[model samples]
Target: MTIKRITFLQELLGLFGLQERVHLAWISSAEAQKFVEVVTAFTEKIKSLGPNPLPAYRDAPRAALAAAAH
Candidate 1:
């Protein structure tokens, strides 16, 4: 079930060229080391990908409106 959800989410993100940002992992609570490793790797991957553009895209319309007001 979780895999199905992740696949669907990946497809949705793919439409926006962000499918790589999605990750699925199964780690037991007892395995803290594994958890740290996975998180560290994912963080590095995100850093390598650079910043997300969604914030700028989301603010564009507001920026245009402000410019028009001026």
Candidate 2:
């Protein structure tokens, strides 16, 4: 169930050409170290991916918000 949702989001991100910006991980609450490791690895991965190509979306929060508010 969770995997389906994650895969769906991953595919959706890919459609927008922002796949690297989203990551999925299954870390148990008891595994704090694993959580840290997953986050660190994901951070490094994102760093390697460099700047996002879709900067306009990031800069135009007002537009997005206004559209959503309406």
Clashes of each: 0, 0
**Which portions of model 2 miss their true places by more than 4 Å?**
56-70
* Number of backbone clashes in candidate 2: 0
Q: Which candidate is the best by TM-score?
A: 1
**Candidate 1 TM-score versus the reference:** 0.75
Q: lDDT tens digits, residues 1-70, model 2?
A: 9889878888889877787688888899999999999999999988888877567568866775676563
Candidate 2 Cα RMSD (Å): 7.1
What is candidate 1's CA lDDT for residue 69?
Answer: 75
Best by lDDT: 1
TM-score, per-candidate, Cα-based:
0.75, 0.65
The lowest-lDDT stretch of 10 consecutive residues in candidate 2 is: 61-70
Question: What Cα-based lDDT does every candidate model obtain?
Answer: 0.89, 0.82
